[model samples]
Target: MEDFLVNINGTLLKGPEAKISVFDRGFLYGDSVYEATRTFNKRPFRIDQHIDRLFLSAEKISLEPTYSKEVILSEVLKTIEAAPFKDATIRIVLTRGTNSDLGLDPALSGPNNLVVFTKEIKPNPAWWITDGVSMIFFQKKIEASGSLPKTGNYQENILANREATSRGAYDSFMINTHGHVTEGTTSNAWVIKNNILFTPPLADGVLDGLTRKALLEMAKRQMLPLPLVEKSLTKDDFLSADECFITSTTRNVVPVTKIESHLIGNGKPGALTLKLLELYLEFVK
Candidate 1:
């Protein structure tokens, strides 16, 4: 078994041997949609939801997938099985495919290419959840589209993340043009105040993250101590909140101890945030 496996359009290859054409629109113009999901004890978590979102993302960008959902899921499982890892992070990418003419028109592109890469999952630092991580507000406004797909075009996010890291922060929190806190570079933002949780609604141009969805569902089922509210939040609201946290597939629920210079809830992981993380892990199990 290999350390990692890459399955390109049904043909599996070693990680180092896997390659795609330079003419592929995904590489040339960043015309592609992708989903990243991780396994819990070798079993994929919420794989169906991930596949559903992947197709939706492709549809939003008008990029038709050559293979059906069943086929994609099958390939993901097959690749995971071929890899030697107790747990893995799976990334499924669907590119607009190759174009010999080097044109921007979708009609010029050939069949879409599907690529699945499965590799060992790298656990986050313990202090990230124990002591908590810090974040900085990204100056640039998020993309205006609320229904934006998880496409290959991530230059904005990449730059924001870079700026945050350079500034000694864990991640960058992005605000939309309306001054509403949308989300982090690759995670959904949440704030708790007076025991009530608040997060920017999908209307605020935030991605419909699966982890965020799971948290919301937990709140709906009364599993959380605080009632979750989907509302637009500004920087002021976040800075003054009693607790703050970010969620993603790989990171799960991690507390944010500070944003820029302002300390969040005593400059440590809040009790509610820890509880939420505990609940999330139980939910995952």
Candidate 2:
């Protein structure tokens, strides 16, 4: 693909040149909060919402932003303007700075903020939506005392996704120790049956995704009944699902056709998923 420019700590660098220090806790300890947003028609989409989520994530993780929201937005726009591709994904990350040689200082300096660094995320393929995709359950269980959802503590997801890929799957469903399907590696999971929408609750340890929240709001505005059943899901629950889909900032909404070896209803994108995707695109536009 084409190269892009990235602005980090007030410096503009090419995609390959953009780099962060290894000493940064975000790198060393995975102690950081991040948000991802995409562009539509070459313009940043829902930028304000994305920035709000970034700040919210930082707050949830007890990490303070090094710059104000306005400044961060300005920097992101600057980076986008410098990129080669007009339409692309933008990522904002904030990390805990180094603790220094003195070691373990709770009173350490404020967070080290890092801006854009040239990232791109294409939408799912046409077939992925029209035909839908299959999902496999990972062997690992979500941790009880997990890091804040905002933080980049995705070690469990990394492993699970790797396992899923090896198993010839499109996505991995992470089950909590209590047997609840929390979420996917990088997307929020949803299942529909008999016209009722069901997704794991935050109590199940799923990230409060912005896309998920927006879709839920849209459904409410349109007088759609969303009975959010935050209960555990079994393999049978997926097989019995009339429709299933995943949501994220980049993917928006993609259909899930199968769970493990069991095929969802008709092995085609469900009507509910199709409606959600159409509504979501209209909402975005």
**TM-scores for candidates 1 onward, in order:** 0.97, 0.89
Question: What TM-score should be assigned to candidate 1?
Answer: 0.97
Clashes of 2: 0
For residues 55-84, what per-residue lDDT tens digits would candidate 2 score against the true structure? 887787777777888988888888777766
Misplaced by over 4 Å in model 1 are 1-3
RMSD vs true structure, all candidates: 1.5, 2.6
Reference-based lDDT, each prediction: 0.90, 0.76
Task: For candidate 2, give the lDDT.
Answer: 0.76
Looking at model 1, report the run of 10 residues with the lowest lDDT sum: 139-148
Name the best candidate (by TM-score): 1
